[model samples]
Target: MGEKSEIRMTNDKKRIVIIGGGFAGVQCAGTLSRGLARDQAEVVLFNDENHLVFSPLLAEVVGSSLSPLDVVVPLRQLLPDVLCRTETVRTIDLAASEIEYESDDGEIQRLGYHHLVIACGSVTNLNVVPGMADHAFPLKTVGDAVALRSHIMAQMERAEVCPHPERRRWLLTFIVVGGGFSGAEAAGEINDLVRSSARYFKNFHREDVRVTLIHSREQILPEISPDLRDFAGKKMEKAGVSLVLNARVASATPEGVGLQGGQFIHGGTIVCTVGSAPSPVVGRLAAPTEKGRLLTEPDMRLRDSKNVWAIGDCALIVNAHDGQPSPTTGQFAERQGTQCAQNIIRVLQGQATRPFSFSKLGELCSIGGHSAVADLFGFHLSGFFAWFVWRGVYLFKLPSWAHRFQVGFDWAWLLLFPRDLAHVRARPTDRVSHAHYQPGDFIIRQNDPPLNFYVIEQGEVEVVRSSPRDQNGEVIAVLGPGSFFGEKALLSNEPRVASVRARTPVEVLVMGKNVFTQISSTLTPLRDALAQALNRRRVDVWKDEPQAYELLKRTPLKELMEPVPQPLLKPTAALAEVGHAFVEHGNEFFYVSSDGQTLDGVVTITDLLRARAAGAAAQTPTNQFMTANPVALAADDDCAVASNVIRECRLKALPVVERKDTRKLVGCIRVRRLLAYVFKHAVIGAPDSCQARNQLAGGAGRGMDWNNPAS
Candidate 1:
C-alpha cells in the first residue's frame, strides 16, 4: 500500500482528487482535508461550478420562500486549504491514476491522483415522457429554481394583461409531475404563491389559479409512514392543490401533461421533480454501471477498481447496514461521502478499511403554510412542529454560517410578509429547450391534443394526413425553415388531425400554448400569418396514420405508390426542350416515349450534364443520353426493394409500372416526394429498423443532381 505513497506525494504531498461540488463531493473533500496531514497530502476538488448548491432549499427558491444567495456557498471560501478548480473533467484513466479535464479557456490539463473520489451528482431527465425535457421545469439546481420562479411570476403578469379567460386560466395553471418530496413541496409552494398573489391583480380571481400534484404511486412520500403521507396529501389538497394519484405521465407538451389514461392536464407551467439521470462523467468511466449509475462495492470502491471510489447520485452504493442499494437522497449521499473519505485515509495509511454503514435520519417534507410532515427520530410529527424541525434540520446542514443566516433572514421575512413579486430575468436558454430528430422520426402525432406550437429552425418536416379508410397517410405539404405547425389545434381547442414527421434531420423551437397565445395576442401580423396558414388546412388526411404509427414492419411501396405527373418527351426532343419541361413541370425526369401509354427510355437533367460533357450541344437528342431500360419500381414491391433500386441505379425518379409485361407507366415517383410518401405512410409506429431503412432510402433519393450529374 505504501509502494506508490512516496511517488504519489507530489512535492512531498499525496494528491487526492474529488469531483463535483454537491453535498457528497464538498463534504468528502472537507472531511479529507481535516483527516489528512496538510504536509503529507493534498485535497483537490474539481467542479464546473464555483459554488456548492444547497439543493434542499432549491425548491424553496422557486416558491420565493428562500433567497437565491441563501442556497449556495463559494467552494473557495468554504475550503480555503483545498485546491479548487472550476473546470469540466473530460476523461479519467483509472489504471494510470490520472484524470484529464478541460479548463474554462478550452485548454486541456491532466493531473495524477493517488486516490480519486467521484461524487458528481445527477442531472434532470425528462425522457420518460415525450417532450417532457423541452416542456417541464426542473428543480435540481439554483438556476433551475430561479428560472421556474421567474416563469411563474411572468405567467401571473401575462394573465393580468390577457382579456381571454381561457388564456388567463392556462397562464395560471401549474402542474407538478411528482408526488415525492420535491414534487409535493414544489407543488405546495407554487400553490401558495399563485393563490396569494391573485389579490395584487384586479383581473385575476382566486379560482383562476390552479395547481395539481401528480404521482404515479397510490400515495406520495413513500419514505414516511402512511399516516404522515396521508396527512401531507390532505393538507396540500385542502390548500387547493388537486391530487392526481396512481397516474403515470405518458407524455408532456407545452400546453400540458398527458396521463397514461385518456386524460390531459392542461397547465401553463410544468415542474418535473422526477427522473434524476446519472452524470455524463460517470457514463465515461470504464467500470461497470447499473443503468448509467456506477456500481460500487460495500466499502464504496468501484466494482473493479480499488483506487477509484464513487458516491452520490451517480453511484449505486449498497449500504452495509441494510444490505440494499442506498437511496439517492442527499442525506445518504453525504454519509456515503464521509465514510468513503475515512476509508480512503485508512487504506492509504496501511490500515484495514471498513464497509460504509449508516442509520436512517428519517424523512420530512414541508407542504407549504408553515406546515410539514416528518418521521424524525422515530417520532411521527405533523403540522407546525414538523415544519419547524424541517427548517431547523436544513438550516443546520447549510455549508457555512453565512448561508444559514441569509436563509434564516429570508425565512423570517417570508413569515411576516407575502412572497416578493418581482420578476427575475433569466436567460432564454435556461428555460427554453430545443431538440433534434432524425429523418422518419415522428415529431408530433395525430389525435393528440396540441400543447406546443412548433417552429422549424432547420431542415424540413412533412405534414401528413391519412384517409379514414386508409391506414397510411399522404404528405400534404413540405415545410422548411421558419415554418410553423400545430397552432391550428391549439387555437381551436381540438386534437391534432395530422402527424408532423421529419423529412430530414430537423431542429425546432417549441413554446407552450400560453406563450404562443400571449405572443400571438399582441402581434397582429404573426397572429394573421398563423391564421392564414391554419385556413389552408386540408382535413381529409388529418384522420391519423393507422399503418405507420407503431408497427415495426416496413411500409410497403404499394401502399404509398401513386401516379405522379410524368412529363414526357419524344426521342427527338433535345435538352433545350427538357429545360422548358423543367420550368413547366418541376419533375426532373421525362419519359422518352413514342407512345404515350408506354415508356421507351428515361431522360433526366443528368443526361444533359453528360451530353454537354461529351461535347454535345444543348440541342442533343433525348435518346442520345437518356438511360435505357432504367430500373423501375414494381407496383406490388415493398419500399425496402424500391429503396435498393433507387440506391443501386443512381436514379432520382423511378417509374411505377402497371405490370412487368406491358411496361405501361402508371406514374413516376421522385425520390424526394417518394420518401415523404413513405415517411407519411410508415413512420407513425414503425420500428427503428424500418425507420432506418426508409431514412436510408430518403438519403439516396436526396443527393441526386439532375442539373449537374457530377454533383
Candidate 2:
C-alpha cells in the first residue's frame, strides 16, 4: 500500500473496508450502510468472487437439486449502498491500515481503511491427510459444489460402462472423511442422488452405489447431543449410508483412503470436510490467535489494534453470555457481524461499545431421504418434520428475494423430477501417490518383497539393520526429506535388505519398482541421486555391524568378575562397628544385608550424617541409618545399561545383583572403570564422538551425558 499521497480521504470521509462477502461481512456491511450516512463513512466490501455463498445449501447443488447460481448472492446487489470490489487480497498492512489487492483488470491497487473487518471465514484444509489436497473433493464454495456434482455424474456414467464388478464398485463408492454437518449432509445427499438416479440407467443398479461416512470420533454431529447424534446416525444407516466411526484418514491415494489403523477404504471419490487451517495472511499478521483464529476483544475489535475488528470463522470472538469462543456457524457469524456494526458506530460517536453476546437459538441438519434433525427452542425434532423445518429456516435466511424464489423453485421442481444426470468431466489424479506413516511403523521390512521405492516428502526415517552379534535391530543412519530409498533391492532384484522405520510421522511419495526402474534407466539425474543414496546406505549397513569385541558391549556385568572385598554383613551391626569396618575394609560404602547374599540397604556418608544429626542412639544398628533400595543395576544387564545407570545416578559405583534371583550379589562397577571400558571398545567402529582416550587415560574426567540416544 502507498503511504500519504494515495491514502488522502476524499471529502474527509472515513472508509470502512470489509475483506469478505461471507455472512458476517454482508450483514456488517448492510447494517453499516443503514446506520452510517454516505457522507459520514464510505463502506467498501471486497471479495475475490464478488458473491455471498449460501454455504448451508451447497450440498443441494452437488446433489443437483438446486442450481449453483441460486446458492450465491452478488455483493453489489445485496449491499446496494456499499461499494463492492472484486479483488483478491495480496497483502494487508495492519499498522498502516492499508490493503494491497490485485484488481480484476490485473492492476495492483491500494486502499486505506479507518475500520477493517476481517470476515474471511475459512477454506477447506485438505493438508491434514496426505495427497488429499490433490485427490479429495472439497465443498467450500459454489464452484466446489459444481465440480463435485459433475464428478458424481461422471462416476455414474463410468460405472455404467465398466464390466468388472470390482472396478464398478470402486467407481460407485463415495466416501466422506467427516461426519460433521457438511460431511454428513453431503454423504446423505449423494446417497439420494445416486440411488434415485440409478433407476434411470439400465446398468446402474441401486445396489451398485455405495456411500460411506468416516469420522474420527465415536459419534457424529458433535454440536448436537448424543441422543440426537444417535437419531441422525440411525436415520442415515436406514437410508443405506454406511458409517465408519472412530476411523480417521491417514492419507489419500488415487486408489482409495487409508485410515490410521492400516485399514483401507477403496473408493473412486473421496470428500474431506474434516480439517481447516488458517490462511497465510493470518499467519503473516502480528497478533494473538487461538487455533489460527484472530483473538478479538469482547467488543469485536482486534485485541492489539484499535482500528481493526474481525468477525466470522477467522476471528475467535468470545461470547460474553457464556464466556466461550463462539462456534463458527452462519447464524452466529451473522449475529457477530450485526453487533460489530453497532460497536463501530458507538466507537465513532464517542460512546462505550458493548460486547458480543448471543446464545445459539437453534440447530438444523438434513440427513437425506426427506429426513432431518433439529434442535429449536431447546426442543429436539427429527424425521420429516425436522426436514421441513430445515428447508424453511434456510429458505427464510437466504439474503435476497431472487435467491429465495430461485431456490424455492428448484426444490419444488426437484419433488416432481429426478436430478439431472449430466455427465461432468472428472479431474485427473496425480501420477505420484503419497501416504503417511506413524513413528515406529516399518515403511519397508528386511527380506520383504520389494514393492515400492519411497521418496521422503516430510519427516525422518531410521535405517535399521540387525547387528551381527545379537541379531537385534540397530539403527544405522537417519534419512530426511528429499532422500530416496529402496533402490538397492530394485537394482539387485532381491528382497529388501534393511527395514526403514519412521523416526517421526512421515509423508512419502511411493513409486512402484517398475516405474522406478524405468525412470532410473532413462533419467540420469534420478539415477545418479539413487546411486549416491544407495552407496551411502550400503556403506552404512557395513559400518552398522557390531565388532567381535562388541560382545563385551553386550556382556552382562555378572560375567565381568571384579575382585573387590566381600562387603555384605548383618544389618544389626553397631554404628561403631560399621564405621570401623568401613575403614578397615578400605571401602567408601557398606551394604546392610540380613543374609550373606541379599542386599537390604546401603549406608553412605550422606545417610550416616542425616542419622547422626537426627540424634540416633550410639547403639543404633547400621540398617537404622541406611537408604533402602537405591536405584541399582541388574547384574545380568549389558555394560551399556550399567554405564547409563551410573551416569544418571551421579554415583561413583552401584551394587549389581541378579535380576532373576535378587538374593545373589554379583559385584559393583565403578563409574571410572565403566567409562574406561566403554571408550576402549565403543569407539572402535562407532561415531567419532566416542573417541574417549584422553578422558580415560588419566586426564581429568567429567560425567558423560550419553544424551544422544542414537549415538
| Top lDDT model | 2
Full-model lDDT for every candidate: 0.76, 0.77
Residue range 329-394, candidate 2, lDDT tens digits: 998999999999999989888899999999898889998998899999899999999998999888
Best by TM-score: 1
For every model in order, what is the number of clashing pairs? Answer: 9, 0
Stretches of candidate 1 off by over 4 Å are: 1-12, 427-711
Candidate 2, residue 628: lDDT? 58
TM-score of each: 0.66, 0.62
Compose the digit string of candidate 1's lDDT tens values, residues 449-495.
Answer: 67788888876566565555544675444555677888878888888
